[model samples]
Target: MQLNLTGHHIEITDSLRNYVDEKMERIERHFDKVTNTHVILTVENVRHKAEATVNMRGNNIFAESTEDNMYAAIDSLTDKLDRQVKKHKEKITDHHQKESIPLVDTEEE
Candidate 1:
């Protein structure tokens, strides 16, 4: 999966970039079809905010969190995104299962 990191009003440091990459890598294990991911980090006053958008085959998952620390914000964001991905996966699988079955036709005796 491709990861694009952006900073708004905050400098993108190597350590922060590496931390984001590592956390996003863990998401690959859960969903292999992830096309791309975009992460935006912003700091406003004392609040650090992290937002992540995951692009999948048929759907997109997004999550955001704000905390005092950037690391904590990222952690919370990813956790929320993980839950969204899992829920979406389950919904998609369930939908396919119900739609894939064909109805049988009976002949009148």
Candidate 2:
């Protein structure tokens, strides 16, 4: 999966990039269909915000988080994305159960 990182009023550092990459790996492990991810980190006064959009085959998941620290915000943002990806994975999975199987009549013997 491709990761595009952007910053607003802040510089993208290697540590921050690596941190995001590590956190995002969790999501990729859960769902392998991720095509790309666009992440935007912004700093406004005392608030640090992290936002991301994950692109899949036929779905797009967006999530954001705000905190006093950039690392905390990124962590929170990835957690939200992880939950959404799991939910989406469930939706795409085949849910049909044993209802399709026909019962055999014991009286046939």
Give the Cα lDDT of each candidate. Answer: 0.91, 0.96
Please provide, for model 2 over 8-95, each residue's C-alpha lDDT reduced to its tens digit, 9 standing for 90 to 100.
9999999999999999999999999999999999999999999999999879999999999999999999999999999999999998
Model 2: how far is 30 from its true place, Å? 0.4
Per-residue CA lDDT of candidate 1, range 18-65, in tens? Answer: 999989877878888999999999999999999989999999888899
Best candidate (score: lDDT): 2
Window of ten residues with lowest summed lDDT in model 2: 100-109
C-alpha positional error of residue 14 in candidate 1 after TM-score superposition, expressed in Å: 1.0
Residue 37's lDDT in candidate 2: 99
Candidate 2, residue 60: the lDDT equals 99
